[model samples]
Target: MNSKKMVLIGLVLTAFFSSLAVFELIPGLLMAFLLLSVGIAVTYYFALSRMRLESLAGISILLKAAKEIGKESKAPEISRQLGLWAQRLVKSEAVLVWWQGEWAFGDEEFTAWPGLETAREWVKNNNEVLVLNQNGGEIFSHPWPSNINSLLGLPLMVAGEAAGILFLLNESKRGYFVPQDSEALEVICQQAAAALNKARDYQEVEYFYKEILFSMLNALDSRFPGFTGHSQRVARVAVLLGSKLGLDEEELRILEYAALLHDAGKVFFLQEGLPGEAGELEEMDKELSVLPMEEHPPLGAQILPDEGVFARICQGILYHHERYDGSGYPEGLSRTDIPLAARIIAVADLYDALTRLAPEEERLEPEFAIKEMKKTMGMLLDPLVVIVLEEVERELDEIT
Candidate 1:
């Protein structure tokens, strides 16, 4: 028998012997002690079994919730899922706040509650989960409104750094939290922190990949004089158009990558004559010119897949030079058959090329470049994209 059962049996035997001494009934005391011991043992056995089952049920709930959270990538959805579970389990209001350099309550969905800003700052500064008993009858002073009696603030740590806090509130009952409650929250927080850190590490790895790709592009830019700033300019214009088009986060990423590395194949075209040498064309330049421009599209498509954002970007790089009519190279896709990202990059790239100072030609003025872009609409470029580019050019001109 467990310690609890043993203690109950000892108490019953003691009571029975004492009663026998007072009433002088020896046989009755023996029967009474035997029956009391049997009853106490049975009761304690059932109570212990029930306690073990309840503990298992609590653990199962946490495990199920953690599994569901692991599959989600969106922040708002994760918060909502956790909040719903908290509401069901604790009968309390739960809010999952996010940190974007600074903490903001989970996408403005729970902004009506007061004192969240202070609470967020506290979590950010301390990097430790806090359990506050808000009811005046309890230990800690209430930081929220009178209706909110208890608070549990869990820091969502990512990669050993705090990312945000998960806040749960109990409005009706105060001082109900025990040491066991805090321990459960700590377990949940640790699981959440691990998942969040994995996600953050994935994002950081992607950023590093993009940085490496851009560094390669920058090196290629250095190989050609008068083109030192060309890729950077194109990237700026592409990002501008991407924002104006209301591209989603994923699409914006693809567009940025394409713009930064569209001229990747130009690395293969670097001539030995150098940028401004004024010498005869080398055999390498002649060979490069004849090496099939059609291959550039496929070559870029091959190199970009390792960077997770490049599936869409490869299409942009391969088809950025394709004309709106069927007169373009490679696939010869025309009109809307061309991807929108490719179409946007085409306009931005051509505009930058036209305005840049070449070795033999004067730099085209912004007005002239806009006019020329308009002239080529529906033939060399997508007409609608040209309209957007014109607007972008005007805005850029005003800023300058």
Candidate 2:
């Protein structure tokens, strides 16, 4: 670039000297002209260099934004990342991500831009790259906060429709938002739109699946008189225990699903040839010599979808019946061999059973249930999980 600039400057100097000779200007005036030409050439070169450098910086920022935003699988996080990236890339004072009707703000120092309804409404209808930079000694004609002298809006388009809009305000330390910033924002929005839309779809689908799971669990629980709200109470207690054990969010989610579906095996208790109905499965199990209660774990695990995320949930359900001392059914997984979720659910299951769902004569208060559970530690329950259950006694009592 410097070499090209030198070549261009040489051509310009050659042209200028030839003009000077043809015009036969006085020496003093000629010297002044030469100085002016040199200064102009130098300023032009520096300006071009700065523009080139800024262009490169914008490209690098866009690449980073696309890579980071594409890596995210959640809509809220995707919008947040895009907002923060835009704020950093363009040095904006504030960024607002309007994701599907939800709004998220990214700020440098938490300055609120008031009275943005007109601008937002206009941008929503226009659905284009709108820029409001009135730096040429002109006041903003739009109804905007005096503090916000400049603004940029980019629509997040998915499948030819707008899924969201991004708004940036007060760029580059209160300076006008340049054209380069707008171009960079357009590229970033193009990259993020599809990802954000897909994340929204996945989120909705996941929520729907959970609703179905809860509905099914409710139906299963309703089949037995004593099992009313049984799965939900177990889930609450399991989550408390899982939290006490320091399980992360994802771990706690799997634990909760497993607890809710722990009794899913009992869904088969209503199958053909079984004798008893409405929570009398134990009597039915003995009378018909049919499939026993211990066999429901595998059946329940089999009923769930085979997705990889649900793998731990299935394992938890499959092994919830297993004992820590190798005395339980099916695989008889012992000690740490039982999945952590299974162990936690095992503790929750017994605790809820003894306190709330058990026969009236067998039922104990929540505190007493914990005390009874203590005796089974390391034999029927994971010792660590049982200890954590004791820690959650205060909360458990309220729920039970």
Best model number under TM-score: 2
Q: By summed lDDT, which 10 consecutive residues of candidate 1 come out lowest? A: 282-291
TM-score of each: 0.50, 0.55
Error of 1 at 362 (Å): 2.8
TM-score: model 2 vs. ground truth? 0.55
Q: In model 1, which regions exceed 4 Å deviation? A: 1-206, 209-211, 268-292, 306-308, 398-400
The C-alpha stretches of model 2 lying farther than 4 A from their native spots are 1-74, 85-90, 93-211, 273-275, 281-292
Residue lDDT tens for model 1, 92-111: 64455555454333435344
Q: 208-320, model 2: which lDDT tens digit per residue?
A: 45777777677675666767787888889888888888886657777887888887777676554343567653421211111247778898888776665567678888988
**Model 2 accuracy (lDDT, Cα):** 0.72
lDDT of each: 0.65, 0.72
What CA RMSD would you report for each candidate? 15.2, 11.4
